[model samples]
Target chain A: MGTENLVRKLPNDIGGDEAGKIERVEHELLPWEKRCHALADVLDFHKIINTEEKRRGVESLGAEMIGKLSYYERWIVAFANILFQKGILTPGELAVKMSEVEGRFSDVPDTRQS
Target chain B: MSEQHDHDHDHDHDHDHAPITVDEKPGYFDLMETAVRELLIERKLFGADEIRRQIEVLDSRTPALGAKVVARAWTDADFKSRLLENGRTGCEELGITFYDDTQLIVLENTPAVHNLIVCTLCSCYPRPVLGLPPDWYKLKPYRARAVYEPRAVLEEFGTSIPDDVEIRVSDSTAIIRYLVLPMRPVGTEHLNEAQLADLVTRDAMIGVIQVGYDREAA
Candidate 1:
């Protein structure tokens, strides 16, 4: 119920699969990865962008990795994961990548993680 | 059944996101986009106009950029060596900065088999060089299939590998990833850069599409 309360305020895109999994970095991952993973958790706030009307049924919860989750969320996490793997990208660069692919016309997409 | 998709197409359609207005002034959400854009700008992260310029650059790109990268590898020995040495730099030399120049790694198709790429996690793609991914590539069908059933995925895109040639499917999960520079086609020797570049479509370079004869002239 507490998780539901946390997600209920979201604009509709950041709900499903986010429960428990979307915890604060200090409490999210194991302490071993708390440093970098926590840093990544900080960037997770950008999930708000997923609220754009163009996207539907997208969920950023780790559960979205399942095909059953909304395609938009799955793609978003996947896109984020790509940026993570591509070393040297700051959070700002990641945001730029998102803006570029926000449309069908832009060349940015996950097919080329670069 | 053939009727399956028809039934799926009947899924609910919500209009809350697309409220109509006379002259269609920016809606609350468009205002939101503006706000977000402004926030990013206000923070001095990136300018709104720079984003527009990036869009313009993406729109203007052609498959030729990839083709030149591929052709240079094919012709000049020094370039080929560099491509082999570092695919990212190779892309830069050919005017393609896939990912930041430091982040990309280009993989080539060998005589024994071909290569194709999939993000598996999401559509992690190289927008800098290849441009926006095709709609199908962005679909769950492609993402799911590209991993567990790469051969099947390739088949859907009209590409198939002979059993003799190894079909290597590279998952671009990390920055140091690979691109499938498809093997040269038959009877295409001596093709000029323009013609050669024509062979390098985003899909072909990804190995979803095969290297084909210069059929455009026909």
Candidate 2:
């Protein structure tokens, strides 16, 4: 489809429900969100690159992944990738660590509810 | 999202921006972030203490800080000029630090123009001043529509601009964060700075709502 035609179909097109119906949802912060915040703070100390560079690396992960991941989740992924690239952490080690975390949390009840 | 441009001039083109959608359940992202954080801590790359400290810093911030700055600017012409000239320095003059490298650009609302802020890519907010961004600000619908139909967005927030006023939507990025300095409401001349600050709401600073005095109370 042409770019102009695509733009015309956007929700913001005149008379669309895009703007008027957008209600804000208030959800409790998920565990991942808390983890992301912590990870973001940790990543702040890295002298290798700036926040913009880290953001670019996350954006380079393609729109599908970008859209799927939450805001700070993207930051963690970018930080992991940067660490891997710098040889601070190896892919093999990270994969093993990820499996370990998954195994550790598999039996725990989901804490999303109080 | 590829169409990148600075705030130098207005762009006339209308483009289809995609909405940011995510799954309800935790998935790879959660596991990845956990694994990465644990690994980093174990490796001594950064300590748990440092992470906690950072979170503490973020937790201490709230919209009240922005309101204080706005209230000061409202009553002080010199401070207002300083804020308009350089937001970072202006904030520093009031003892409000940037807290990070991200540049803070305060957009002033006037009779001729109304300003709205959004981070289409991600929720890049001025954490030091405004605390965390509200959920709606990070949602897909708002991110997609705020730039394209700002007037309608404002209307949804109960803010109606006159036809003569122009709306400028500022899309924030990782490098620069925006804070909207709403015009002080009328009938507030008698109010002191503390009283003025009381009138400022988080939504008002985000430009989704206008700051106004309660007519019945006055």
Candidate 3:
């Protein structure tokens, strides 16, 4: 494809592109990943954001971030941005809460709350 | 060379970096997940327990659910037709609840034709029945190759389809997900539905591999 087409093409549109061998690796979902998924469900269930909105949210992240981040990583990041766009949560609020949460995990590397 | 080696290992030389490093700090995304979730709860958009319940619902789903439907179709001809006609209704008959509104299309494999599913745009999958897709399914290569050269992709999973067999690749979208109903292996006529269900692996349902019957010695 030409540069013009590539520029217009969405990042997730990778069908029929030449690619390497498939790595058949099965990863157990970490606790945070499951929680991220659940957050998606909760967000959709309550109409804060629907599934299509979330899909578009991830797509809006562009190709570079999509390729670099893990699946749920893209989602969590997208969710934050989408929330920001919707004015549901501000960046300042999220940053403050993240620091507050981070401080709670003293001496423990796992920062997720039980 | 020694100077270069020292520069590379300078940060790590202070600590014993073994084969497994357990004390690694969390990444930015990890913090974002906690922050986003906590903010959602504190804002009363949803309660924390609601998220917990949703996780429980997701955990309750697995490939066993898909296998049960496949085994039933193998034994009951009526169910097979129904599943082919409308997958969501067919699965609902088996008491499986679909949380989403996306349609489920069950593709059947025969001697002359094979079916494979891929989500090129994103990781759209039949999560209600088969749970989350395998890691390979969500990756770029499988999504890119499966639509064009499905036979080659299947071969990577150790499933070789003869040239005579037409490979029908289904590209899933956000609105439609697919499940493959693989052919039952021969010499398993004696096996019960439960026994047959046990043989239907996730890979088989994904159409990457055939359900192999390795009969334990009686």
Candidate 4:
């Protein structure tokens, strides 16, 4: 429990008592979380790509996007990317849908405006 | 003298301001998911009803399935052998079908050894039996510490083992997921399989804690 004389012994160790510190933060799942799980389930049934392949696709997004996303959020992104790659959905259609969703959200008052 | 002390305390307070909080609004990923889901639905890639059904399948899974497997292993020796040999097929004997192609491996904790699981790369879990991985399981600290300093991480979960006991940490991957079958607690000889399962907690199956015999006393 006490952090004294902490040493980073392993090169790959990202966080540990001797390396990065540990902190706990608890929060309820956001709407995107539930939706992402559903999306992953649907993608699983389609069998268009294996879990590892999907995971690699997510990893290919680079660290910045990965850092910004939640665990399941990455899955949804990977699922969508795979769909696009497979020609099931064109990039043009996805762009249109994204703008449509954004338009819907724009009507609501921005809570973070303050 | 009091004014000097007050000035010193005020200086400390200046350095103790609360950290800036990040905006918690949904990001580009959320919008992308919504977009993809809507497009998929529109194109009939999969119906809304199908997604709902799949979610229900995920929601139906719980740690009770894992507890039943553990309790059976505790009572039946042959069943335990089968479970140790082939995790997925053995669980199927008890009517537990693992989701998709993910392999399940059950680690047995003995008197001399303890097993803990963590997925350092991603939160790979035996979701068919244990349901969703807890938030802590997916966090970076637990993932990193579980591999480097398992005993310390176990202690954080309120599990303390003697220095003599060996702690083995398993890193779960996308292909293979691990579940720890905790050692059966002492003084539970009279308990039936159903009764013993009641003592098996989700945390115990995750190897963060041990199953207790307090239910018997109650």
Best by DockQ: 3
How do all the candidates rank in terms of lDDT, highest first? Answer: 3, 4, 2, 1
In candidate 3, what are the lDDT values of residues A1-114, reduced to their tens digit?
Answer: 388977767888889889999999779887778888988888887888887788899999988899888999999988999999999999999999788655543344453334
lDDT of 3 by residue, B87-205 (tens): 99999999999987789999999999898889988889999999988899999889999988888888888988889999899889877999999999998999999999999999898
Model 2, A1-114: lDDT tens digits are 467754544321222224346787766556567656645745755664456667677766666677676666667778878888888889899899788655543433344322
Error of 4 at A28 (Å): 5.0
In order, candidate lDDTs are 0.50, 0.74, 0.84, 0.74
Question: How well does candidate 2 match the true structure in TM-score terms?
Answer: 0.78
**Candidate 3 regions off by >4 Å?**
A107-114, B1-25, B216-218
**Candidate 1 chain A: 10-residue stretch with minimal lDDT:** A15-24
Better of 1 and 3 by DockQ: 3
Sort by DockQ, top down from the best: 3, 2, 4, 1
What candidate 4 gets wrong by more than 4 Å, as runs, is A1-28, A102-114, B1-28, B215-217
True contacts kept of 3: 0.78
Q: List model 4 lDDT by residue over A1-114, tens digit each.
A: 424322422222243434344454445556567667767767767776667767677777666777776777778777777887889888888888787665544433344423
First chain TM-score, candidate 4: 0.66
Between candidates 1 and 4, the DockQ winner: 4
Sort by TM-score, top down from the best = 3, 4, 2, 1
Q: Give the better candidate number (2 or 4) by TM-score.
A: 4
